[model samples]
Every structure is written in structure tokens, then in C-alpha cells.
Target: MKAKLITLAVVVVALGGGIALASASSEPGSGPPAIGVVRAVRSGTDIVLPFDAYRHTPAEINVIERATAVLARDCLNRFGLHWAPPTVDAVDTSRPTAAGRYGIVDAAEVARLGYHAAEPPDRPSQPQPPLDVLMVYTGKGASDVGGQPVPEGGCLGEARRRLEEGLPAAMPGERFAELDRELYLTAQADERVQRAMTGWRECMAESGLRYADVWAANDDVRWSAPEPTPEEIATAKADLACRTRSGLAGTWLAVETAYQQRVISERRKEFDALATALHARLAHARQIVNR
Candidate 1:
């Protein structure tokens, strides 16, 4: 029997509202001045996880999926069966997607897609192979066919093993969650961030969208409707406009960054260890993809 291959998707959402002042480039002598003691510790490198390394970039995800798919295809082909590879896209990590970020900044997007994420592009369907073939691919035990025992760990497992060799078994986001929490707490307590929040609230009130804060605006009952109503759309647009007018986003980002730098300085040793581990993992991932 062929094994049924299970594909896992890893999603990472960045927390905190800091502006990244340092150059993201690993190279020295590039971009703006490094921020504070954190920069001193790592030189020019950014302390936070790089967008590509946060979870898996679309490309990295595709590589792993393609590797497994190829293994499945080859295994099935041996028995005169056919299989198809999975399609993937690199994740977009450029901007924050948190509900509190600008309180639905993209008005046009909200009007078009509402609160839901855009539907992924559909792919052509492929033929399913026989149960035995699936069992072998999935690593589920089944009686040997053609007097050959199924490969240990199935082809899918073997493919994953190869792609993930030397990588941490746990998801990277989990490890970074602690850092994110600390940064978030610091931002909440920051007087500058609080001032920005107050200004944002006043701006919203001017637009007749009275809300306590971004969180209140986001959690408004009007948005709970099955589809976005006209009022919801209008409020969302006004919310974003007010946020911009108040310069809340920029202020929050700057304050968050400052707080994060402080935290990084205090936790220098821990962050340094994390940075080293992440660098090694990323290098290993690049090797796998290139090979």
C-alpha cells in the first residue's frame, strides 16, 4: 500500500508594534545606523527574526513540499502509477497583519475581500493512486506488493528527513513567542505608545467612530456580521484614516522599537544564543534548497 503524505503548513504572526530602525541586511556597512546596545552586541545584524526565517518562506515551503512530492511520484511511478507535485508560494512578511495594526488600514482590500484573507488560487486536480500506493507513500504498513517491503518511514517521511536534517524539531515561532510577549508588554507600558493611542482615539472620535482604542475598534460588533456591511466598511476606512492622521502607526512602531532595544540589551545573552541557532538553521535550510 502507498502511504498518504501529510503536508504541514507553518504560519507565524509577528507581535509588537516596533519600527525596525536597523538595516535588515546581514552585511556590514549597509543601511542606517544600528539601534543602541542591541546593535553593539550583534554589530550590524537585526536582532529580530528575518522575514524569510520566521517560519518558512513560500519558497522554502515549496522546496520541502516539492521534495516530498517528487519522492512520492518516483515511488508511485515504480508501480506504473502517477502523482503530482504540490504548488506553493512564498509568504508575505513585509507588514504586520495583526488586528490592532492600523485597524484595517487597507480600505480597498476590506471592501473587496471583507475581513477574510484572499482565497488562494486554485490548482488543477490530480488523480489519486491505488490504496496500496498511498499506504507506501504515507508510511502506513500494508502487505508487501511484488515481494518488496515498503521503504522505512515511507517515501514522504524520508523526503522530510532529508529536507529537515539538522533543523530544530519544534516550530521556530514557538521559540520566538517569549521575545514577542516581552516586547508587547514593554510597548503597552511605554508612555509614548500610550500617547499615540490617545491621539488615535481622539482622531477616531472626530470621524464619529468612537472607540476606546485599536483593540476596541477591531472588536466592534458591526464587524461580526456575515458580510461587511456599508457601516462597517465606512468605519474601517475612517479608522485607518484617523490612524494615519494621528501618526499612530509610526509612533507605536518607534516606541516599540525603543522598548525592544531595551529588552534586547537586558536579555543580551539569551538573544545572542537564539540568533546563533537561527543563523545555523537558516544556513542548513539554504543548503537543502540549493542541493
Candidate 2:
């Protein structure tokens, strides 16, 4: 199954030395504030689950792709064509939070790799397969191939259909993007988040940095340069220090957690359906891979 990937707006920083920093928007009156869910609490903190938990791991995704490739290869072979499964790259989709969430908090990484991390070598681009091969694999409106009518859905689609039998047609993580957006907007108006942002701003001021918010601190033109300037590095260090001192990331996390709990309660049914479908798809994919 194709994993549903969503970008989370609320950034939670899991810092080193046991400091979990959090921050939230201080903008006033964006929309109605989120209400807390009564039954979503566990030991005072809201029981919020990371969305990545339901996603397929890189290894699992590779397995699915390999299975699909195998099906495609066999279909092409029937037409006296030799085809090899393309080498699939595994994407790391397991990070709990997005990179650069706290804006250059990783001093070591910044010093070593600058603004960007080293990317893996890309797969070699291959030319399009012959028309007969394409017709068998993709069902590209060929009347007949190897004296047999091309199967409905083509080879690739048939493989996916088999792998996703008894599951919903919708992609995994489809509803999560909408849910994250709603939670983020609602969190911005949360009273607790506003108070936390105020404390964060004051902390930054005390450190001789005058920024309205974390976003503003990150918006400097220095950051947009082809390379990181010395000023940008120093500013990033200060930003991390101030955020840590104010506990901005931790505070924002608490408020956002409550909001997410409420969202989970409201969307429990949809979440469950998505989870079940994804599990079924993975199971089918595993069966295909193991065979």
C-alpha cells in the first residue's frame, strides 16, 4: 500500500540533554479555539498518537514495490521481452517530527552538512520500455499482446488490486492532512499556546534577540543564501538557546497535544477505518513478498 504522507504544522523539538522544547503561534483571533476531549486524557497529558506509527516503513514499502515489479516483469516476458524490476529507493518516513522543526538546532549537523543533509545516490534514469512491453505492463490500449487480451487494470494495476484486496480504495493517511491543518489552526488560537508564545518572545528579548516569533526568527534573508553565513549560524545558536530557556517547544507541545486529542475523538471512526485498511494492505503485500 502507498503510505499516506502528511506534513505536520506543529513542530515539536526533542532536544538533547533531556530538554524537550515546544513553541506555538501567538497570532490572535485566527479562529475558534479547540475544545479538550474529556476521555482522551491519560495521567494528565492527552493520549495523542504519532501519525507515523500507522505508516509503512521503508523496508515494507520496498517489499511492496518489488512485488509490483515482479508482476510487471512476468507480464512483459509473455510478449518475448526481457524486463528487469527497477531498483527502488527506500524513503525514511519514520521521523516523528519534520527536519529543521526548531531551525538549525542540530549544531553538529549544521557544521558538517550545512543547510542540507547528504542525499542518497539517485536511481539511474531508464528509458521507456518498448510499446509492447508498456502495453502489457500498463494496459496502454493495445488491442492484443502475445495473442491474449491485455488484462483489465494492466499488470501494475492488477498487482496493486491483489495487494489491496478487501481494503478501501482511498490512499492511506488521506484524512490526516486535513486533521493536522485543522488542529494547527485551532492550536494557534489556544489560550495556553498564546501564553507560551509570550513567554518565548520575552525569553528571546532577554537574550538580546528581537523576534516576534520563531517563524520570524527563521525568516532572515541570511538563511536564504546559497550557503549559511556566519551571522546565520550565530543567530541559529541563539534561537536554539532562547527556545530551550523558555521551554517553548515543550509548552507548545502540551497545548497541541490537547488539540490533537480532541481531533482524535472526533475522527475516531475514520482513523480506525484507515488503520484497518492499511493493515490489510500490508498483510497482502507481505504475503506476496513471502511467496
Q: Which regions of candidate 1 fall more than 4 Å away from where they truly are?
A: 1-56, 71-82, 88-102, 110-155, 166-173, 259-291
Question: What TM-score would you give candidate 1 relative to the actual structure?
Answer: 0.59
Residue lDDT tens for model 1, 91-190: 4333222422323445456565344333445656556656766887777866465666666677666665554456433324444554455455555556
Predicted candidate 2 versus true structure: per-residue lDDT over 1-291, tens digit per residue: 111122353221111122111222222323334534323121112223354444554565666677777766776676677777776443443343334333333545444433333244456776687776777788877757768777677877666655555666332343444455555656655676677667778877876888877777666555676666677666666666665565555555556666655444555565455566666666766776678
TM-score (all chains, Cα) for each model: 0.59, 0.65
lDDT of each: 0.51, 0.54
lDDT of 1 at 140: 88
Candidate 2 segments exceeding 4 Å error = 1-48, 78-81, 93-97, 100-107, 110-155, 168-172
**lDDT measured at residue 86 in model 2 versus the true structure, 0 to 100:** 74
- What overall lDDT, based on C-alpha atoms, would model 2 receive against the true structure? 0.54
The top-ranked prediction according to lDDT is: 2
Q: Which structure among the candidates has the greatest TM-score? A: 2
- Residue pairs whose backbone atoms clash in candidate 2: 21-249, 21-250, 22-248, 22-249, 22-250, 23-248, 23-249
